[model samples]
Target: MLLAILLPFLSFMIRGKIITGIICLILQFTLIGWLPAAIWAALSLQNARAEKRNEKLIRAIKENSK
Candidate 1:
């Protein structure tokens, strides 16, 4: 996520979110948008992590119940 802090737009690209990345690129160009871009990228990363953990938890529960 260090990269995301440095280049917020790239975070979306790495995640295959081309359109959102493009939007971030535009926002990044506006100097004032820098902070918000970083915040958005960081939040997105956290959300992705949460989703992965939830999926793993569900899988584990299913296996245990079987």
Candidate 2:
């Protein structure tokens, strides 16, 4: 139990990226065997969502300006 908890924290302690840490944290709860894979998956999905949201907001602002 402690190691499962510590694995994600260890990744953080090593100064890994924020999204990577977040994914590891999730994997600790969800998929014990695929923590590393989950990290990449989470990061990619989070980034894509953020980018799409940003683009939508930009478009909205541009339309409002006209």
**What are the models' TM-scores?**
0.95, 0.48
Where does model 2 exceed 4 Å of error?
1-33
RMSD of each candidate? 0.7, 8.7
Tens digits of per-residue lDDT, candidate 1, 1-66, equal: 997889999999999999999999899999899999999998999999999999999999999999
TM-score of 2: 0.48
What are the Cα lDDT values of the candidates? Answer: 0.93, 0.59
Whose lDDT is greatest here?
A: 1
